[model samples]
Target: MEEQAKQKLKNYVLWLLSRQEYSRRDLTFKLQKKEASPEYIESLLDWCESLNYIDETRYCEGFIRRHLAKNHGYARIKSEAGAKGIDKTLLAFQIEEMEIDWFQLARTAYIKKFSNITDTPDYKQKAKIVRYLMYRGFNYEQIEFAYTHNQS
Candidate 1:
């Protein structure tokens, strides 16, 4: 019975992976929700890893690519990755390795939203832009750089 259940879970996991890459934690939670035994889930995850079917680094790379294409800031990207159950250390390593220019991305995002600014913005306008950038997951330094360079 346990073997049958494990086979079912393995098939389900493969099907899920076919749709998208998932972090180990994401897979664990998903399997748990499906009533899979914790022991089976752990062993299954190990098997998946051994087979190279589940890899954190690969997942992170793909995730970063997709989000960066959407013009998300580093902060927002990191936050979203964390929410998806990626380890902070691994995420930091990937970010550093990728050499992502967060400030540049932030500037691009601001430009897309506001178009080109011909004159220096008023205090109120600057504040609104700052708030929007922050909400978009940029750190203070990245936001400042975007505002300074983009503002006329």
Candidate 2:
């Protein structure tokens, strides 16, 4: 490849990466959209990886941290990462590494979504909260303790 062509691809990759952390798959797709040649694209990607300009493992860890901070559940994160072409094994490992109180995450989301829920002692109200939590990717067993414990 000509030096000029290689530089342009590298520049595009650098610009795309400078915006935010991206999965390798995301970067590849974006570069392809730019019509970069297959050879330059592959070589450029390899160069970035070698230079540690795009570390997918670090990107995964950061993505997990940010997504969890947004109160997203394991299911949503798992599925989202899968869509990004992240391997199931890596997703599982990252989910395991979260090491967070998922109940608290669920509780916070529940409270935020239904602040008026606990004001009344209605079964229907409780059921709605339960359903909401489930929709947010929480397990019934995990949220059970929060529901019972919150009453006191």
Which candidate number would show the highest TM-score if scored against the true structure?
Answer: 1
Instruction: Write one digit per residue (lDDT tens) for candidate 1, span 48-140.
Output: 999999998999988888988888888888889878877889888988999989999988888888775656667987898888899888888
- The candidate 2 region of ten consecutive residues with least summed lDDT is 143-152
Instruction: Go through the candidates in order and give the clash count of each.
Output: 0, 0
Candidate 2, TM-score vs. the true structure?
0.86
Candidate 1 residues lying further than 4 Å off, grouped into runs, are: none
TM-score versus the correct structure, for each prediction: 0.88, 0.86
**lDDT of residue 16 for candidate 1:** 94
C-alpha RMSD for every candidate: 2.1, 2.2
Residue 118 alpha-carbon offset, candidate 1, angstroms: 3.4
Candidate 2, residue 147: lDDT:
66
> Model 1: what TM-score?
0.88
lDDT of all predictions, in order shown?
0.86, 0.77
Model 2: pairs clashing at backbone N, Cα or C within 3 Å: none
